[model samples]
Target: MRQLGGTELKRLHRSWRRKDSFRLALLLEDVQSPFNVGSIMRTAAALSVSELFVSGRTAAPGSPKAQKTALGTGRYLTWSTHEDVATAVRAARADGYHVVGLELADEAEPLAAMDLRRDVCLLIGNEDRGLSASALGLCDAVGYVPQTGRVGSLNVAVATGVACYEVRRQAWADAPAVDSGDAE
Candidate 1:
């Protein structure tokens, strides 16, 4: 119930860094909101995503709003921008990653059921339009976060956070247990 002191928090951060095991990337295609982009950057860093690929009209990580929302986390993430989404997807695929689109298309599967154990490049689309038809076609798979509430969807940033968490959850579940080296 007590707030963690700076020293304790630093130790916790270092411990988390040592346990980083997932190889995940993010591709934001034409996401217009700087706030959303920044928020996504923070979430990506927290989840240990290896990189971010921004394409089309998505806000750059250096944008003021993005920087503000990222709270200094933007510098910790490796990000690149492309003039087109296809180029980014192709590059990710060439690098031995599965490019999955986070969209709500009719053919999309539920996020919880998707296999994310392998290296992943998650493609996130615009706040309003979702993924472009061409972008969706390039993805190896499309997944949507299941929702039962009155709201049909979540904010783009919120959805990205949820998706990232799902990936991390799956990785953690599949990872083999290791000893911490502390004596009982």
Candidate 2:
């Protein structure tokens, strides 16, 4: 099998487009690491998330370390800073998006089981504390990635990637099939 070269890969990416406009927003609360912010930006851009909102003490997208890790992807993403998590959550809800928190809480449902077909504002918290109590209270629902490994939790960036993928997966599954015209 042959691998696609840079030009071909770029062309492939240009040709790919989402069939449905699934509004997926990411809310980062008090995530201090610039590297993590950048990494999450990359993941969000790659998955075509509609917007990113960084709140509280989360690192800004303009941070040097974050920009370095983002490798220019941050420039292409729609992101903004909010005064606090509550305001961000309120804005998302006001805009008709379902605010869901990505945290391992007793009330959280498995990520795979949640119906992600609606517009979602996924709330991810700080590296150490996860979502704050107030943040959790604001979420319409909470979801957690089920893990069986020795480690009880995943890094925030990794968890964001997984959750984004799940959202996209469900969107694709719900989308009507289109014929590409390939035939024998």
Best by TM-score: 2
Candidate 1 segments exceeding 4 Å error: 13-20, 176-184
In model 2, residue pairs whose N, Cα or C atoms come closer than 3 Å (at least 3 residues apart or on different chains), thus clashing, are: none
Model 2 error, position 95 (Å): 2.4
Cα RMSDs of all predictions? 2.5, 2.7
CA-lDDT, candidates in order: 0.89, 0.87
lDDT of 2 by residue, 44-148 (tens): 888887889889999998899999999999877888788999998887887788999999999999989999988998999999999999999999999999999
Q: What is the lDDT of candidate 1?
A: 0.89
Tens-digit lDDT track for model 1 on 1-184? 8777877766665554554466889999999999999999999988888989999999988999999999999888998888999999988887788999999999999989998888889999999999999999999999999999999999999999999988877877765553432322
- Candidate 2 residue 124 Cα shift, in angstroms, is 0.3
